[model samples]
Target: MITIPREIKEFIELQGIFAVGTTGVNNIPNISPRIFFRVDENVIYWLDFFKHKSYKNIQANPWVTISVFNKDDLKGFQFRGIVNFITDEPTKLEIKESIIKKTLEKNSSEKIKKLSEKIEVQVIRFEPKVCYSLNPDEFSDMCIGSDVDSTQLFQK
Candidate 1:
């Protein structure tokens, strides 16, 4: 299991949306934008609100990938792993709290507030099997893998 670093976690928190990728048994890929997501230790969880395609895809194939980036800085992290749908009370409570917290933040729309209350959100958890950093310094744009000690990748 790989542990997410503090800097990466902080960067993710500052972002408004995350891109999640999943593929079905037929190998058709699906990407979706997610807002209600939280990372804890080695697990990353996101709330799925009426995402029928994503829900169906994950059910067919457990493997998934997540791409997170700060467009302004042009830096990002890509994570690949296995995913599971969790409907446990504790995780559901966490998702509810996240929705409440985001609603309290600036520029939250009435639609978002209403959706939070009405929708049946599913908590999807991702356990990272490997991580890669998208670095553009090289001509080919090298992607450093975290399977080996990820500390080396963080050390500048």
Candidate 2:
């Protein structure tokens, strides 16, 4: 797994939702907005509610790319990774606490607790293999943590 740099990690944290790309048995591409996302040390996780289309797609193909950006700044990042579906009591509780406490930073413990009880959540854990710049106009898909020659980085 590739380590996500602090800049990229902060970029991800600033965004509330992400567009996740996936393809199912027919091999057609799908991009769906995903919330309830959390980034741990080396892995990222998002929630799938009610077995959505993205969940079905991942069942057939685990490969996915998560994209988030700031329109005003024209800055973005795309994370390419494989997802593993998890549905366990402990994981759900951990997700609940992390998402509500850290990512959302919500102090409405009672309200969030009630909401968490109502929703049946399926966690999609992401293990990123590579990451790249979203500014193709400027960087030409410069990879953040790749093994490409340093000279390539100098071109821009």
Best-fitting candidate, scored by lDDT: 1
Task: Work out how many backbone clashes candidate 2 has.
Answer: 0
- Name the candidate that leads on TM-score: 1
TM values, all candidates: 0.82, 0.79
lDDT (Cα, tens digit) per residue for candidate 1, span 1-156 = 688888888777788678999888777889998777778778888878785888999999887889988777888888877899887888677766775576448337888666667557787889887777754543223434445454453345
User: Relative to the true structure, how large is the alpha-carbon lDDT of every model?
Assistant: 0.76, 0.75
How high a TM-score does candidate 1 get?
0.82
Off by over 4 Å in 2: 103-117, 146-156
- Model 2: per-residue Cα lDDT over 1-156, one tens digit each: 777778777788877778999999998998998656788767888777657678889999898888988887888888777899776879777875677556446334565455555556787789886677887476745567643353443243
Model 1 residue pairs with clashes: none
Clashing pairs in 2: none
